[model samples]
Target: MTSPQPLPAYSRDRLAERLAAGPVVCGEGYLFELERRGYLQAGAFVPEVVLEHPEEVAALHRQFVHAGSDVVEAFTYYAHREKLRVIGKDGILEPLNRQALEIARGVADTTGTLLAGNICNTGVYDPADPATHAAVREMFTEQVGWAAEAGADYVIGETFRYLGEARIALEVIRAAELPAVILLVAGHEPVTRDDVDITDACRELAALGADVVGLNCVRGPATMLPLLGPIAAAVDVPVAALPVPYRTTAEQPTFHALRDPGPTPLPEDLPFPTALDPFTCHRYEIADFTRRARAAGVRYFGLCCGAAPHHLRAMAETLGRTPPASRYSPDMSKHVYLGADTRLRAANQAYRTSL
Candidate 1:
């Protein structure tokens, strides 16, 4: 195959020109209110028929719009055809996706916020793994087609763990010819999954015609820095950084997933927790991620797993400090944790002399 073409030069106005003039932002990439609304079961997060609490969902959109998000995304990430088939509602994909978009559009109309149609990971990666991609592509094409037809300004293919899957979704978006952005999952280290470095994956997807290349999910803002550098430099398009509120260490696998039928405690639910708040955890991470990302020249910003309207509000506040149409300039290539300053100093001294 011939070498891929270079990514087109990005002009924010040219990109924004395709979209209606507005704040043009999303509150969060995904928000799960399953247990809170009594939809909890074995794994109620992926349920059939949307299980939408209409008033609550609408209110969330309004909250984000009021918080200054120009775009409000519908809660339709997992509403795929195959997912619905498990619960025996294969016919409702169009309606549910439409309803989800309508919910956001209703609030958008009232508050003048743009609505973004959201598509998410199929929960199963490695599409090349025999018969894996067939159904997912059909489901995504149907869902994305509906999203494009439902007056969505743009679509976000988010929280993707594999680049191959992202490219499939990107192709679907291209078929619809709707402007699109991709959010990949880059783990805390230089990890490779399915023989693809998460950072290289972002650049490849952009070459396939993704409008923006960035990251979402992964551990948290503190550890995602290693992956962001390559994506920011390799792709000429806008780079967005949205880290999830996950555990700092591998000690707790259940930190993100709920354990019991208990009140949804904020991140601070644990007594020993001193840093991240449960309810506003995404905001805390986003605050730091956006700060460093802005310094790294990332222009697009949003949240991913374990995010909410509050986090989006904080991101908007941070973005507003410097208006759009301005350029990004950041210093400090390296950052050391306050607790590790001593060791970092020693390491820096040794490396400096070697240089």
Candidate 2:
């Protein structure tokens, strides 16, 4: 109910010192996951829950921390002033962001986890329009200042579709002297929304002084892996990938377009609207993605939309580390079953031996 006193700011050097320890596992997807849990309204997409329902937001942060997330990112993904204005609650932007940070900071402090301040795409990012560029800068400046004051260890600018806008965000975060990460949403394509080559864009973003640079949201890991190759090859800094947990195909690249007007399905009955069901990735699949990402030199791994605690646990297991306490675990008494492909391969090998 009361505002938290500002914490000491972390310098960029301090952030780098933390990163040098090892890879970081960040947990995002709060907006979509909350919507799935009936905490947020569909289509509205405002993170008003931080102000109205801090417990729900804090509970989510705790889940991620317990699921092995090293970073507890504040739920400010859509808390931008412009976004609040759409809902006629622009007056609450500062309170919403500050409160979100307070919740995350509390969890991080208790768990010894790092807190990341989240900033994302502003729909109006026109390089040619000076007024729009100015507005974007002002927006990020205000949001970053609030996050920094709230004791965020770093700031993440994610789900950006435009390179120009991403650059602006990186500039603002860097100017604050905090470590900055810029993640773009280019689907499976090798180009930005503005038609800039993704590989080239990664190179440029790194030059812009982003501590980390890579992709998030839009596509799932299978589709996002190939895209990360060029980015890893391009940047010397650590690369991050937080893809959605859906089986995204070439046809439906972005998750935003996957929404339907039908009623929300129960959690037990996920991957509804059978047409897009194939896009959903299971927990094991997320583990596989983590393995491949590590092989590709991606050190900062995380999940985006549809990600749950199970997915993060799987990722930790795949990395050959002990996972944090989880609500579910594999039944050791049951015989594990490999897929049909494995069975077919075994049969072929047996036949060859008999020959």
- Alpha-carbon local distance difference test for all models: 0.63, 0.81
lDDT of 2 by residue, 1-355 (tens): 4432322344676457656876778888898778877788756689888887899999999998888888899999988988888889989988898999999999999998888998999888876788998999999999999998997889999988889899889888877878898999885466887799988888888876778999998788877888887799898888999998887656656654454434766444434323344456888899889989988889888999778888888886776656566446665332233333343466565555465
Error of 1 at 68 (Å): 2.9
TM-score of 1: 0.74
Clashes of each: 5, 3
Best by TM-score: 2
Query: How does candidate 1 score on lDDT?
Result: 0.63
Q: RMSD to native for every prediction?
A: 11.3, 8.2
- Model 1, range 162-235, lDDT digits (tens) per residue? 66778778888777767677887655344445568777787788787787778776456565655677778898
RMSD of 1: 11.3
Deviation in Å, model 2, residue 73 alpha carbon: 0.3
Which residue window of length 10 is worst by lDDT in model 1?
Answer: 323-332
Q: In candidate 1, residue 334 scores what lDDT? A: 46
